[model samples]
Target: MKHQPINGQHHVSMLTKDAKQNLWFYTEVLGLRLVKKTVNQDDPSMYHLFYGNRNGAPGTEVSFFEMPNAGQTRKGTNSISSFSLLVPNDEALSYWASRLDSFEVPHEAIVSIGERKSLTFYDRDELTVHLVSAEKDNGIELVEPWITEDIPPKYVIVGLGPVELTVREASRTKAVLEDILGYTQVRTVPSMGDSKVMVDIYETGKGGLYTELQVKEVNDKDRERPGKGSIHHVAIRVKDVEELTEWAAKITAAGFENTGVIDRYYFHSLYFRDPNHILFEIATDGPGFEIDETFDALGENLTLPSFLEERREEIESKLHPIR
Candidate 1:
């Protein structure tokens, strides 16, 4: 197998109009633990909420940046399109379908995507989400689910699955994935009924649902007008800071301008945009969320990196309370 530096998706971040509502949908409705309650380091005026398993492990997180006045996202090409979460088995998919209905959350009937059955739905901000069964795949390791009284641990989302990237030209992004990032193009499949678009599957380390990146080639649509509910970027996991440095050099050698390595405090990160203008991040796995908060007290308090600690009072003054 060809060596790939990226393990799988670390986390997929999207835009949300309301942080409190976003918190409720993922924690109360979906049963993911609010692992980190912090502000976006780039823009400290707003919030960045992270949800994942009990530990907020790399592959399981789904995050959001609060954009208070942002409008609805306009769907089109050149976008991250949708993000999926893994369910333990087909039975879990069934449980989620009923759970979503009980909350009056509209969703599509479960349908087969490749060898796995997936149910599609939208969050409160209309961000596309899929609950895919991992029964047919044997590669990914399950993380400890955030235990909840109402939802069974078996049915809770285990980790993030294949992230769909819908772009005008797949070849451009394909070159970046395969040539620069060392990903292998695994297969191609028809999207759904009658659509001319073909979804190309690409895999990295350990090659399974969690490590796959699906690229949908669609030429008919316009470029996306990103706002609320639109994915900002998807972070790919690397083992540590040393490997991340190697990747920074590799990306630079490829002639693509990138944010060299950044100290995120929790995990170091390197950011770059693909040819389609879709932002991609390569992030380290260690020095995790527990660096600041204890495992049990993870997301309970407002946590800030050392540099931002000085401005905590001012930052808190600008933001609305979200709990």
Candidate 2:
């Protein structure tokens, strides 16, 4: 049976120890435009910052939560091993490498993944990040010198590229991505242990940025504890709000408890989990980053959702000052 696929890449959110440091790295160093700044609805003390291309568009954003003084996370089974970002091309990568060196940020030389080249590096809090030159044709806008100059933000993001996750039961998690999420098994490659299997699901094209679920050999199985530098959630994109609602029903029918549609200001969202315990969200592509702020003024200040607007004073008081 052919299953309906979701649309573009929505966003990926991470937990951070220092919001200010992350803001500087993403905005000043990485060249991602800060689109929105708000607080966690449930826990207003923590600030939620969204960074991406020109306007924090879907498939381009990498959001973060500022949880000050959070504990360290264990890198093992049931955790997202690594996350990747797609740059425009090799030239963009070279530009980034030189900039990182100038900033005194330590990073490895380019590494090859098939025809793709990547610069693997760690964030200030130790979250693994990869800036890869993807083969996809992304028409999105990009800020050149990702660290130095000011350029108009681009709209192209090759969706979410290959999220590497660590899981004890590889086959079970693979089933969820394939059978439930409609992802197709692309190929399997040898990794540190058994074999690194890759499953891909695309809404736009065959290639481009897709999720990569990796099964790592672990000595034991354990629940992942939330901590600083951990991926709080990885969001996949659906075409629109209607598709998001359909996925909510599909996810619940599959026996996983799903959070119904959520208004994330820019887009609606639904969240569920795979058997391996990684949190996943299905978000819409409409009502984009420019819904509230103009394209030019994207990452300028704190932007709040209407629900949190009434409690702005309380939220600001709780969050630590992050310049």
Candidate 3:
């Protein structure tokens, strides 16, 4: 049986040093809504914050891990080179340029990427961010929530953009993206060095939910050490639970180890590292943020999965309140 194409982004998870600062950066500065308030299951000592468009749609999400004193990430080889978001048009991009300026946020002047225009900036943790005038995303349609109603609807960020993944070799990565993940090569552009970089645009068309796998000719021996400002994993969207299983089979058959299916409460997930050891995830798009709270009350209080319900008090106490 044939399955759905891996759509655009499900979510991009990154590490941060302070939850409060990260919260302010995404929610207040970027005007995204904090839809989920929870702790990192792997390490309950840390906070896992989910920020995205109005209702926290799959492709729109950008989640963060908050660990104090974890240090900052160093940019080198085998890392997620860039992450971007989609706005409606150049006007929105201009508004962002001025909005960021008002906050004294240092950012790059608007730049063009392929056919789209974009403004680049850095979060408090120094993680790079881009706001692009998106093309058209024909992927799974989403009801983009404008939770921050005061912000102009046209200027609000709709979803994610193509994220660049850096790898030492392109052959294995190419095979995995095409055969295993089922992505088509959209275009290749001349980059800084030799061997043009491959650009794979998803149905995330207009929104730029694409992936740019950079083929590095020289193997830099220095490895990436994860801390603040580093991407934890880049997740691509799947239709549902069953499709996730199919992905697991295909991935394993291709000789990559995966985390199988994991219940993240809101959505199901399967994780595997790329040839470059950059973490990648395939996540379902359903049973989203509303499953736990009313649409109006999202991010208002602490939320725990059923297993962690008993320890809610302890968990709440440990986390410094951001809301």
Query: Best candidate, lDDT-wise?
Result: 1
Error of 3 at 178 (Å): 0.6
Error of 3 at 260 (Å): 1.2
* Segments of candidate 1 deviating more than 4 angstroms: 1-4, 192-196
- From the highest lDDT down, the ranking of the candidates is 1, 3, 2
Compared with the true structure, model 2 gives a TM-score of 0.85
What C-alpha root-mean-square deviation, in Å, does candidate 3 show against the real structure?
3.0
Per-candidate local distance difference test = 0.90, 0.69, 0.75
lDDT string, candidate 3, 1-323, tens digits: 56667776788999999899889888888888898988888778789999887788887889998889888677766777668887876788888899899988988888665665778888888887777676443432434656474578878887776676666665666667777776666656533221244444323223334433333422564676777888888898888999899988888887888899999899999999877787888999888999889999998888888888898888877778775
Model 3 Cα shift for residue 145 (angstroms): 3.7
Candidate 1 per-residue lDDT, tens place, 178-238, comes to 9989889998876532135578889988898889899998888999999999999999999
Output the number of the TM-score-best candidate: 1
Model 2, span 1-323: residue lDDT tens? 33457543567789989989999988776766777877776677788888876556666778888877789886667776667777766666676677778877777787655555777777888888877675444433333322336522331223345566677777777787767887666555443112244423222334345444444544376757778888887788777887777778888888999889998878888887887788888888779877767877776767777777888787777776667
Instruction: List residue ranges in candidate 3 displaced over 4 A.
Output: 135-143, 147-150, 190-221
- The pairs that clash in candidate 1 are none
